[model samples]
Target chain A: MVENRPFLSFLTHLVLIVGVVIVVFPVYLAFVASTHGNGDFLSGLVPLLPGPNLIENYRLMLTEGISTAGAPPLWIMLGNSLVIAIIIAVGKIAISLLSAYAIVFFKFPFRLLAFWIIFITLMLPVEVRIIPTFKVVADLGLLNSYVGLTLPLIASATATFLFRQFFLTIPDELMEAARVDGAGPLKFFRDILLPLSRTNIAALFVILFIYGWVQYLWPLLVTTDSRYYTVVMGIKRLAATADGEPQWHLVMAAVMLAMLPPVLVVIFMQRLFVKGLVETEK
Target chain B: MATINLVDLKKNYGSVPAVKGINLSVKDGELIVLVGPSGCGKSTLLRMVAGLESVTSGRIEIAGRDVVKAEPAERDIAMVFQNYALYPHMTVRQNLEYGLKNRGTPREEIDRRVKEAADILEIGPMLDRKPRQLSGGQRQRVAMGRAIVREPAAFLFDEPLSNLDAKLRVQMRVEIRKLQRRLKTTSLYVTHDQLEAMTLADRLVVMNNGLVEQLGTPTEVYDRPATLFVAGFIGSPPMNLLSLESIAGAPGFEGLNLPDGTDVIGIRPDQLVLDQPTGQNLALAASVELLEPIGGESHLHVRLTGSNQAVILSVPGRPDIAEGAAVTLYARPADLHPFNRESGRRTDTAVANP
Candidate 1:
């Protein structure tokens, strides 16, 4: 831009185009495959263009699903995913906000120890502690339930840390001002601190919603009941039928459905998400 | 309005004392300004009064009631912060209404106070705008409006205008003084700016190193600074403090009778004259080092003829004085303040030979 080098600009465009193609190619292929008939994938490398059986594949997946594989209908799985995503997003925000507030504002014994304990959990992802976590959930009789799918995933160190960082950047004088305004601690937290955190909460919701939705291994581990299966894990069952070559058309259709809600969320709330992400991390 | 008293208020952070024992009685409806350079504990004292900081070893009483153990809210005081601390999410109306609402004021009363405050601040048109939408000066007004609506027993201002531009700062300073006079609220304002303190305060409490160096009206402190710290800290171009030993042999001291332990002399730059007068008690020959013409007055930086100790003299308009030129400066005996170097206290009992 500084020198106005046409060649460099052309090179930049070429590189961006290549990057975009690489990212978009797979989703395009999945859509193409979802539009095809059953025989297309069996004879050749999946279809590259729109097929005439698009409505049939999507309708079958949404209404009856591939029942032979023990997967529930797409609508039921999608609904489960929706419920799990919302609960995890809202739950993580609530707990993290309260914890972050306490950690940042109050002076209590063992506060640093508490913060470090929460911070240590960041190093331990769900995959690392999956087995023990599953046993605990099963022992609590939360297995095959929505709580089983979401609660374990709700204790997020990232979201807590984000809120803590955001809270720290707020001027100390604001707190003093609130105190002088006759607001007690809870009142200050509710009236001043919470409203100020709106953007951060929304931003974290988008990321956490996606995080809760795309969970495959955790849901696969806990929910043996078909009714509790989320679309993300249910797509695996649709793809791995017991006795035949997998139904590529329906599986691809289910995959498209599973990715849509979160993708739309990120797109629609793009501005707030970017702002929240940048500010909280700062 | 009510009198606020701080009796031997002290604060320490892990054995490091930030505010040493300080005692002051702020009269009802008086605008007291706590002023010093940064780290002077003026803010700490203000915060203690506001119940935002804990007092280590003394008491803060508001309206004759001991509030040492009370929360900030329970203390019944309002504060305007240095940054204006307006809630970014709330409209000006909401910000003003927030405090009264929390206190469970009746809806009609809240609206009445909010309207009155908005009218007083002349922010009526901006009541629906967020703080971020307002300018710095407007935000400052909203901050004050928030305090005004509370109608607390006292108002605590923590360097509220320090963040504005120079022009706006002066404007807000005048407006704040006018507003305080009209409201007659017991206010404790803090600032590191001496000019703001001098202009806005009914009485000024000048602080240094966590101690009150001087507490008096602006004129009293300026005319008779209690110590070397107050003498140097309160004035612009600061008072010229020269050790008496440096000019002990000067001609003007031939018939002078001074206090026994007097070692330092403070002379205001404005009091130093270019021409020797008939009744002036002190005269010294100085070599001009530099001249700074600041609009209507010129500051002549000069060194004593026999010593390297430099002193400044403020003369009206541009003077026909050049750098390195020898000029005789005179001061009346009454204008020269002598102090003991060890105690830094003015040796006011000094009697000069008549």
Candidate 2:
């Protein structure tokens, strides 16, 4: 039995080691292509290790790569993304928490209808509504701005659905207790309900941040001017070359940079996400 | 402290009526328990009063204020939940002080109320601990402390002890009764456990299928139940109700020979006796079907002579009879409850003396 146990673990370790390499190789390729010159990238000599050309590539990227179409600098785009993302994540989650709280904790007219309507939105993919959404954004004259990018994404259906499920599991007595404590709706949301749902918030934050960052088509349509291009949009155009050629290396570099925030957030946020799900079980 | 009043309270979920039209008045310093079986809408009614639920169509008043339209917060009431809903993130001290702080009460007064509640609940040592860190009983204490610190006009409890184990439920029952008495707060408690209702309530409201079957003091409801539903519902081992037509007073059976038209006879098992000296008295001969030894008492499942039907009798530790053995039993007519079988209403009768 002891021998079998040791053999089983050794086999498990071998499988995981191979699995991680397969998953990480594409990311490693992106990081490697970022440091190499355009020539080395064209020749397809994969940079397996760190290169000394980091500074030269970054300088070129800032001077010409990002400023090609009058778009903001790389750092400016990062800052804009940070602002947009913070607003989108916080706004969407606030709307989600409020709606879920009402549906789960309070009884009112047309509650079931509200629930069904919100749930039905999840049935139709956003891609299906892209044309209609684009027309609405154009009519609102929100083109080429941060508002255009973050507004529609701010009304979340998935987060609200998830949070409502979580809130239902919260005993009705807790809500009653909060009411008895003289906590109004806003006070209850701030003092009791929101504090209790820290884990769910953490989970939703990561989920929403990634969802907002990886957005391409909507941002592409909304921000018609290149000056307002999000990082993802910048990457899409970099590789969409004519004359039977594309900039694979620079495009990968921008993709790698755009991927950084969500990676960092997931690392920091996964702990609370797991903790929140665990707390719900209690 | 203030009284709670419900005028024509009605609650409907879609077309299914939960609490049909009912009126109730809870006086100040009174503890009224709503007792019923599952699906009886007691909890729904309580939530409506708390404003956690809409009235559907009704009026509620607390302290002579028209609170039907008032916010739960504006109503100035407190509630204890069955699951002991202590804020999981907050320490016992913060949980107890949260309301006072939100209400803009003086900081020093908040501390005083928190301290008093902590002392009363004996949770002073655990004030800094989060609710997740406390045991079930301790968490229950903190939930109560959170409400107690509020000092609201009235308190509402929703099956607060139902989550505890049997022994803990009994212990918490007494503890809650003592706590409510000390506070002298008008309280409305809901539970499906009739034992809890009987022991804890100053006045008990018995509900069944969204209707008030009877509302009276525990003794009044127990002794003179207004309906067969009450007689069948409000006791430990519920009262035995056998129709008078189901039996004939044959050879050994000399049971109560009431008028031929009597439909149902209700008798609590303990009121029945064995070895009757007067054959003419209320007595019957029955074959013992099953004998259950329940520690200090034995429950006999007996089949009366000349009848194929059964009746359960709760007697002392042991009765001198084997399971299949036939024996004569005696009971007083004062212990008998005659009910109009079709309507399930009580027939006029005399009460039994202990």
Please report the candidate that would top TM-score against the real structure: 1
For each candidate, give its TM-score against the true structure. 0.96, 0.85
lDDT of 2 at A118: 92
Clash number by candidate, in order: 0, 0
TM-score of chain A of 1: 0.96
> How does the DockQ of candidate 1 come out?
0.62
> In candidate 1 chain A, what residue range of length 10 has the lowest lDDT sum?
A273-282
Indicate which candidate wins on lDDT: 1
lDDT of 1 by residue, B287-339 (tens): 99999999999999999987789999899999988789988888887788888
Off by over 4 Å in 2: A1-7, A36-50, A63-73, A98-141, A152-154, A218-226, A236-256, A276-282, B4-27, B53-61, B64-66, B245-262, B277-280, B349-354
Correct interface contacts retained, every candidate:
0.78, 0.80
Lowest summed-lDDT stretch of 10 residues in model 2 chain B? Answer: B247-256
Go through the candidates in order and give each one's DockQ. Answer: 0.62, 0.54
Per-residue lDDT for A185-212 in model 1, tens only?
8988998899889888889889889988
Q: CA shift at B309, candidate 1, in angstroms?
A: 1.3
